[model samples]
Structures are given as structure tokens and as C-alpha cells.
Target: MTRVDLNADMGESFGPWPMGDDASLLKTVTSANIACGGHAGDADTMARTMAMAQGNNVGIGAHPGFMDLAGFGRNRMSVPRGTLQNQIRYQVAASVGMARAVGAKVRHLKLHGALSNMASEDAALARDCYEAALSVDPDLIVMILAETAQQEAVRELGCRWASEIFADRAYNDDATLVDRSKPGAVIHDPDLAGKRMVEMVKAGAIITESGKQIPAAIDTICLHGDTPTAVQIATHVRRALEAAGITVQTFDGR
Candidate 1:
């Protein structure tokens, strides 16, 4: 049986500023990449989100990004390599300690926003960010964007990792994500998103917008929780995968 994990970003809500319907999203996703205060989320949100994930038996992950709360970490920034590494270490440590306090454990580490995009294209940067996280938890599972430099970093490091494809985002012919500013870059139609995921998972590759199939490992599918139709897309993707006889569960890394 073909199996894949469904993951969603959560815990982005700051104090008095709630973001993403985590409760509803948790019902459909098997794994959660929770924001660890670098881009979004706070100590309170982390504890609350971790508690919710533990109650639902969902796998928890530390989501660290560039410290740009004003930009939600989506805006790309140039930071020193050592600073970026320390940022990752700091965020992962916070996630690990908080999860322990809530009686939950963070099983994985996923880079967020611009940091993820940058790492997808730069192997050295990907290694630096992931290395910092691994320093905190040597057994941590690193989630990499499939068919990208992030994957290259993981392969070279010989660490446990999972390859991920996005359900709501379009792919370039080179397998990098289409820029968000482009038309049709972000798929909003739930049906289309669901159909695309089913196709990629069954083929064990990333089906680019140009109809090119880049052969890669498809261990998990991500549904961005900040989008308006994120929850709907996630629900449809789950149903579509199950309908096509694909098993959705937590990933054990590749």
C-alpha cells in the first residue's frame, strides 16, 4: 500500500491575533509544523497548540524561519550565516523545551517561509539551517522540499528526512515552487488541489505546471494553513487521497 503523510503549518497565532483554524486543520492533517516564534507564534500559542496536537495524537514539528514577525517571515531577507544558524537552534530549542513541558514531543523540524524557499535553492544554506536544528536534537527528522537543494542537503547529511510537496502551490519546470506573485501560482480551488496531490503521490513525483514529472520521494503533502481556503483544500486532499486508495499517516522520514 502506498502511504504518505498530510502536514499543515499551525500555531502561527500571536497574542490577540489568531491565525489559522488549527482546530479544524488538526482534524485532517496527521502532522503539524508549528511556528516557533521566529516568524509567528509565541510561548503561549506554542504551549496551546502543542497541547492540542498531543490530544489529537498528531506528530508535532518545530517550524523555524527568519525572525520577521512583521512580514510573517514570508519576505526574503539577507542575514549572516552564523546568525541564521543560531536562529534555528534557538527556535528548535524553544520548541523542544515547550513540548516537554506540555508532555508532548517535537518529532521533526521544518524550515518556514523565505528561509524554506532560500534553502530549496541553496544546498549550503539548507545544510546550515538543518545542521543547527540537528545540533539541538540529533534524532530530529528534517522535512525537505522534494527535488530541490533541501533534498540534496539531507542526502549529504545522511540524516532522517521526509520529502514534501505542496498541494496549494504550483511548481516551476525546475521543480521549485512558482512565485506567489504569479498568476495561478497558488491554487485556491479545493478540487484542483486535491486532484493534483493524488496525481503526484501515485506517481511518486512532483507534477510540475508544465506537465513535467520530476521523479522524487513523496513522503508528505503540505497544505499551508494561512491561506483562506487552506482547511477546505486539506479536507478535499485527504478525501481524494483516501478515495484513490492512498493511506494518509504520519511520516517516519526517508
Candidate 2:
């Protein structure tokens, strides 16, 4: 049977302000890429989310991004490679510490928001970020955007890694995600998202907006947890994959 991991970006709430229905999402996703202090989470939020993930038997991952609380880490910034690497290391270490406190180990590291977007195109940046995370935990699974510079960097590093595709985002022919400002860029329909995922998994490639098929490693499917219908979309995708004989489970980062 074909196996795939279902993951979601989570734990973005900061202080009294809450974001996403992480509790509901935990029930659907096999792995949770939780926000570290850099992007949107605090120590308290990380601890709470880690405990919830542990109780749900979900794999834990650190979601580190640029230190931009006001923009939610979506705004791009040009920082030095060294600075980026150190920032990533600091965030991953903080996440590791929080997970340790809750008896949960962080199994992977995924770049978030603008950091992720930037690395998908720049191999040097991707290398710096992954190297930083691996420095903290050599065995850490780096969740990378499939077929991009991010994947190229991991292949060069030969580190434990998993290639990912978005369940709700359209892709360009080049495999970079379509600009969110464009129409049909961000999928909100559960049925559409679920069907696209099934097709991509079965084909072992990403089907772009122009019907271009880019062959790549498909290790995990990322579902957005910050949306209103995120839980429903996740549930629908899981069910669809299962119905098609695809096993939804946590990735071992082979």
C-alpha cells in the first residue's frame, strides 16, 4: 500500500490571542508542524500544543520562520545567511526544549511562511536553514518543498528529510506555489483539495495550474490549519486517501 503523512502547520497562537483549531486538527493530521517563538508561538503556546499533540499520538515538528510577529511571518525580509541560520537554530532549540518538557520529541523541522517561500527558490538559504536545524539534532527530519531548491539542498546534505506538497495551494509550472493574490490560488473547497491530493499521490507528481506534471518525491501532504474549514478539509483528504488504499501515517523521513 502507498503510504503518505498528513501534516498541518499549527500552534500559532500568541499569548491571549488564539489562532487555528489545533485541537480539532490534531485528530486528523498525522504530524503537526508547530510554530516556534520566531513566527507566532510563545513558550506557553508551544507547551500547550506539544502536550495536545502527544496526547493525540501525532508526530511533532518545529515550524520556524523569520521573527515577524506583526506580519505573522508571511512578509519577506532579506537577512544575512548567518543571521538566518542562527535564528532557525534558536527557534528549533526552543521548540526542542518545550517538547522535552512535555515528554514529546520534535521529529521534524519545517520552515514557515516567508522563510519557506524564500528557501524554496534559493539553495544557499535552504542549506543554511537545514544545516542550522541539523546542527541542533542531526537526525531531525527536514520537511522540504518537493522538487525545489529546498529539496536540492537536502539531497546535497544527505540528511534525513521528507518532501511535501500542499493540499490546498495551486502550483506554478516551475513547482513554486502560485501567488496567493491570484484567483484559485488557495483552495477552500474540501472536495477539490481532497481530489487533487489523491491525484498527486497516485501520479507521484505535482499537477500544476497549467496541467503540467512535475515529477518529484511525494512524502507528505500539508494541510493548512489556519483556515475556517481546515479540519473538514483534512478529514475529507484523509478519508479520500484511505478509500483509494493510501495509508495515512507519520513519515519516517526515509
Candidate 3:
């Protein structure tokens, strides 16, 4: 059977501000990328998310981001290779421990926000993050941008990778995401997003902003839990994929 993984970034609630509708999202997505005390999550939020994920019987993955909470980890920092590796290791370990505390195991390591962008484009950063996760737990799968540096590093390091695509985002000519600052960065219409997702998975291609078709591998689909209609988007995508005869599952069998 053809299978696809459905993942969502969870645990993004900061001190007093609640960010995504995680509880409903966790019910729909197969994998939960729990934030590892950086970018947007705190200890309480992480613990709560972990508990909720466990209750819903969902697979767990570590969502490690840069230590920049003010910019929500979207702003890149000029950290050395070694510093990046160490920070990634620390965050992954924290999430690993948190999962183990609740008798759950982290199925993968997914870098978030700026860290994900950097690792996907910079070979050195990709290798650093890949090596750090492998050292921490070689069994953990690495979820990354489909065609970027992290995927390349996964190939070189012989680590498992889940090629991920976004369901509600626009693609540039090069197949990378359009800059969020751009006018048409995100697709807010649920019906349009659902149709685009079906086309992306079934045909394995995305229509770029310039009306060019680019090959896309859809091993996993990501829905930003922080979006206003994240829950509706996920629900619609799941139905569309299932109706098209694709099995929506997590990276690791659950």
C-alpha cells in the first residue's frame, strides 16, 4: 500500500501566549514534532504536549530550533559549526528524555524554523545536525526539507530520512518555499490547500509560482499548527489523501 506520513509542529505555546490548536491537531496528524525548549516551547508546554500525544497514540519527534526565542527562531544566527552541533544535541536530548519520562520514544529529529532552513541549504550545517542526532541516537529518523542540505547529509551519513513537504505553503521556482514576506506565501483557503495537497501527493509534483511543474517527493506532509485554520487544513488534507487511497501514517510504524 502507498503510505504517507502526516506531521505537525506541536508544543509551540510560550509563557502566557498559546500558539497552535495542538490538541485537535494531534488527533489528526500521525506524528507530533514537539518543540525542544527553544523557539517556542517551555518545560510545561512540552510536558503537556507529550502527555497529550501519548494519550492520542501518536508518534513523537523532536523539533529542535535555534535558541532565538524572540524571533521565534526564524532569524538566523552566525554560530560556529561546533556551537550549532552542540545546541542541536542538547535540545534533542532534552526532548528524548522528556519522551522517555512518559514511556514514549522519539521516532525522529526534525530541525525547526531557521535551523531547518540553514541545515537544508548549508552542507556543513546539515552534516553537523545529522551527526549530532546520530550520535545521540542512531535509530532516530531525520525529517528534513525534501531536496535540501539535510536530505543530502542524510544520504551521505546513511541515516534514515523522511522527505517532508508543506501542505499550505507556496513554492518558488526552485521548488523551495516562497519567502513568507511575499504576498502569496501561504494558502489560507482550506479547499485550495486540500486540492494542492492531493495534486502534490498523487502526481508527485507542485506547480510553482512561475507556473512551472517540479518533481516533489511526499514521504511526509507538514501542517503548521500555529496557523489560524490549522486544524481544518489538516482534517481536509487527511480526508483528501485517504479518499485518493493513500495511507496516512507516521515515519515509524505506530
Record all residue pairs in model 3 with backbone atoms less than 3 Å apart, i.e. clashing: 120-149
What digit string (tens of lDDT, one per residue) describes model 3 on residues 29-62?
Answer: 9999999987889988988899899898888899
The weakest ten consecutive residues by lDDT in model 2 span 78-87
Off by over 4 Å in 2: none
**Angstrom error at residue 33, model 3:** 0.7
lDDT of candidate 2 over 1-254, digit per residue (tens):
79999999999999999999999999999999999989798989999999999999999999999999999999999998889889998999999989999999999999999889999999989999999999998979999999999999999999989999999999999899998789998899999999999999999999999999999889999999988889999999999999999999999996
Query: How displaced is residue 72 in candidate 2, in Å?
Result: 0.7
Query: What is the TM-score (0 to 1) of candidate 2?
Result: 0.99
Q: Could you tell which candidate, 2 or 3, scores higher by lDDT?
A: 2
Model 1 misplacement above 4 A:
none
Tens-digit lDDT track of model 1 for 213-245: 999899999999999999999999999999999
Alpha-carbon lDDT of model 1: 0.96
lDDT for model 2: 0.94
Report, for every candidate in turn, its global Cα lDDT versus the true structure: 0.96, 0.94, 0.85
Residue 181 C-alpha lDDT in model 1? 90
